[model samples]
Target: MSMIKTIKSLPMAVAAAAVLAALPMPEGTPIFGEQTAFAQRAESNKKQSTRKVQALTADFHKKLQKAQEAIDAKNYAEGMEILDDALARKANDYERAVAWQLKAQVFYEQDDVRGTISAYEKILQFADSIPEALEIGIIYNLGQLYYSEEDFDKALEYIQRWQNRVDPTLISVSNLQFIANLHYVRNEFEECLKYIYQAIEIGNSLETVEVKESWYSIALSSHWELGQYEKVRDVLEILLINWPKPRYWTQLAGIYQELGDEQTSYSLTEAAYKQGFLDDNETQLVNVAQIQLARSAPIKCAWILEKAFKENRVEKSPKNEKILGQCYMMAYEYEKALEPLSKAAAGDEDGDLWFQIGQVQMQLGHYKDALDSFASVIKAFEKDKSEKAKEKTLSATMQRGQAFTELKRFKEAREAFKTAKRMATDRRDKRMVTQWESYLKAEEAREEMLNG
Candidate 1:
């Protein structure tokens, strides 16, 4: 299961908007090596001079460069023919690696995934013969190719190699964020966090939201999986500030709930509701009401739930009706509570809804209505085997006794109390039933004396 539940339906934070941030260096300066590669450049220049004296090998190199240019010009057949001629001659591994790299580019341009992969792998096999800069470039592009094909394992493997080779300052924050996303897809959340936070820091310094969504998503999910609720909230807050979407708001409030901070959760959901972000979502609307109810604001809870139900914004299911009924009862709106409570109880077999209805009726001084609700509770309990289920039965029978006593029905009150005693599931409950019976007997004697 994904630790961040809300991300699944949202836009996937792929590396779609990635852009490499680089220095405005001299044209030939390698991205990973500024002046650090000067010795390698000098040695390469010496190699060029050495190759220039050998006419045949020099011709092979020039033909390979022409092939690359041909491929770039969309002349694939010409490029392949030149490359075949160049390869038919005896060539060094370095020259062959360059030829394969160009071949891969042509195949990629034609959307030949298998050919691109094969060519790239062939180039990597000459790893020792390839220049350091070209090696890093090849590994990075390999990661990109595998990622494009959704082969995340190979993509991550090559990307990690590229990351290992580069100067951290040279690679774009977007690339780092992409690596983080790969880790996220693979469920290596801890490593995902390491790279994503680096990406976020770089992105913050650069002041770009281009891949910020992806960075924050990976961060949020990673922190959540690590059980770092506060960090999860931090990422969510960043996303909410920049994005301000309903989903982020809900996720932010949900993280608050996970942290056991209902006050913050309730306030945050209320904020979303006030901003009209949650008005159209039934689950969000219900969440808002639940938060309000938790905070002892049942009037607001009932108002939101009742209006949503009436406006057809939310479904009027039995479970929802029960919640609505409870909201009304908590708000002391017994008359309004009765309708949904009755509807809920009518459809429920566990008797919990009936117990709720009886509580509401008893509070409203409706003794007969309360008695009927308790009867339903008892009948439901008759078929239930668990002692936990029987708990409600004991409470309902005792309530029935109270209802009978209130209606001045002494014989029925004694009978109800006797049933309560028989239904009790434990010594503690049995003692409570015994006390109710004693109280009922005293009331009976007092009533008989008064009548005499």
Candidate 2:
């Protein structure tokens, strides 16, 4: 009953890469409180104290400028060392704070995350009191770093806190973009839609294509997840108006499938296949056949598969063969089912296909053949070396054993049930074993009575 379909959107990494241009700061400062802080500093300073602080600030400023020059030349270690010496020297609180900010920027540029975080933490602790803008900017950068690390929880923690500090009406598109991405990463699709829509609303008022495209991307994924097929169709109609591509065809086909509109799904899928939207040429042909079969159009299904085979489009894939077998079974061509069913059973050697083959054989009145097929499936499953497989094997064995008992093969049936009892670990299987033990005893008693 699951309606899960192929993802229409790119992988998170690709989407992340694609939306980079929409992001505001990327890895830079979020705000600038330094100008206001400088104003306050000027107002509060006495002449003598201001003179001493200004001289120290001038020296630190010169050292910071030289460090920037070194950094520009790609001598990061040398630049950081010079900045370190400046911070270590006769520096007041303000100079030390600016030196830490420079140090953080240098480490961020060098992609040393831990070093950058450490320096940023120092900047926020000391500089936040003097410069609120720098504090917000540092926190925003921390959000970016956490996101890069794929740490959604920490990223949200920082970004949400930053959002709380900033005015919503004044919030930049970049901030909203990061928040939307953070929500997407956390699978909080609802929150993601809210923010992305808000960004779109804001962008529409300003008429920015950047935010419009972001809106389209969000709408596509959100509608798809919510199974709003009509909305998906409508949005895709608009998308194709601008970018008429095969991507929409496939997505629309899947959505139609979810809506139980078989003919439309079939039509769209065929169009996609013909247009080379389906890369697996043979598999796509078979998929079209499956859609027909699901619609009770087995004749159409058979024709498509036959054409696929004749054109060398079909691979000798187990999946394709299984589909072909099921198609033949539905068409009441049990004889035709034999070859594909046998091949599939051998290829997978799994319990399900074996049971399927057994069912087909039984329908054809080949009871002994059915018994053998089911037994093979049971034995193969038992030897699979997987605990879950073994559990499945036990269930298959029990079913096969019951079939044998009904066919009056009591000895084999008893043996199969006994094997199931030994292999089974689940409570349900244990109860089945107990029931079969009583059945086996009853069968033995009836045989004894007959002989007596």
Candidate 3:
């Protein structure tokens, strides 16, 4: 199967916001903070050295408060003007960082992502003056902002930086998933698998957590990109268990087929069909029927096709009709096969389908109908000079003789056998024709005795 087609079939989130939303935010912190708390705190235990807490100047504090009030009132332009004036006053690192933080809030409120990114970048320039937690949060937000901008390389860079600084145990499943998706968009399948597995593991361990469906989708797609069929199958099975959607079932079946496990593939496809998952999918329905026929479940194949035809799900084209007829014939449902076979035969220019129709009619003991089918076959091949056509014409004539014999029409049977003998180039065909002629004589004798 083409991975591109499979990828296209998967239901996945298209928005970068979905990726951002999937990440767990700090307990009370929004995904994108409008304001960073300027009050300083001690560094985390993971940090070797604690940075000194920086306090905002009383004058700058008053200015920042005024800016916050304007922003809160939705007077964004007024808020930006005050912050720009405060920054122009030659503020210290701490005061400058605080001013930029308020500026970011204004830009964010204005829905200016680029402006917000610029303000946040300025705050990072005073990284040492800001609290460690606040700095880390800014880094994480920058990654998400870059993602929203579709700058995947920068997004991965900043997110990885945040991951390096934070405690692994504190990372949420959604955060891991966000990182995994970043790797996925970068076409780094191996890296994507690493983070996705971590996310799944974390998600599984938490009793209250329900792993997001997109997490498994990423795993499945990554494994496929890496050519890991077994892992892909495993992920698909998990997805089927948790989600139980039609695409998962079909995708898992396809994986099994790629692994050369046709039996399992057929079983999955048949199960999906039984659940009516394949009903709305015309190609999948036909595929399931074909698999059934290949697996020697001709009756099931015939029934499926028959129902699909009635429901107008599958097209009633000549090729499809022939398949339906063949399925019924294979299952020894000769009476059921006759109609489709005859319809298919009528649509076909070559006499092959007509020959099949004649054979089915013979099996059903409809010798008169069989004779007519054989006549049609002969007529179809009358003008064709191909060797195969000649062979088929000869076989039809011989069957025509048998049909006449079954009807006790001894004179017509003799003529059919005679014609067959003249057309026979092979010694075996000649011998068969001679035997039919002898059978015709016995039929004549039997008929006479019965009449007496």
- Number of clashing pairs per prediction, in order: 0, 2, 0
How far does residue 299 in candidate 1 sit from its true spot (Å)? Answer: 1.8
Q: List residue ranges in candidate 3 displaced over 4 A.
A: 1-48, 291-295, 345-351, 362-386, 393-452
lDDT of 2 by residue, 200-298 (tens): 677667855355455666777876777667888877766766666777777777777787887888888987876766655565677888877877888
Top model by lDDT, which number?
3
Between which residue pairs do clashes occur in model 2?
24-174, 30-137
State the C-alpha lDDT per candidate: 0.73, 0.67, 0.78
Give lDDT tens digits, candidate 3, residues 1-452.
33223222322211211111212222442332222221111133355345674555667767877887887789988988998899989678877876777777666656677777788888889988756666766777678777767789898889889888766656667678878888899999999999989988988888987888888898999999999999999999989998999999999999999999999999999899999999999889889998988988999889999899999999887788888888988998888888887888888754888888888788878999999899999899999999999999999999999999999888888999999999999889999999888888888998899999
Position 290, candidate 1: lDDT: 80
- For residues 1-452, what per-residue lDDT tens digits would candidate 1 score against the true structure? 33122212222221110111121223442232122222233344322222211112556557856875787679999998998888888887766765676676566566576687788788778766645554566567667667666689998889888767766656666567777777888889998998888877776676555555767777888888888899989888989998889989889989888888878888889999999888789999988888778889888888898889888988998778888888888998889989987888787664887888898789889999999999998898888888857888889989999999988898999998888887776899889888888888888889889999
TM-score of each: 0.68, 0.57, 0.73
Error of 3 at 158 (Å): 1.8
What is the alpha-carbon lDDT for the whole of candidate 1? 0.73
The TM-score of predicted model 1 comes to 0.68
Candidate 3, clashing residue pairs? none
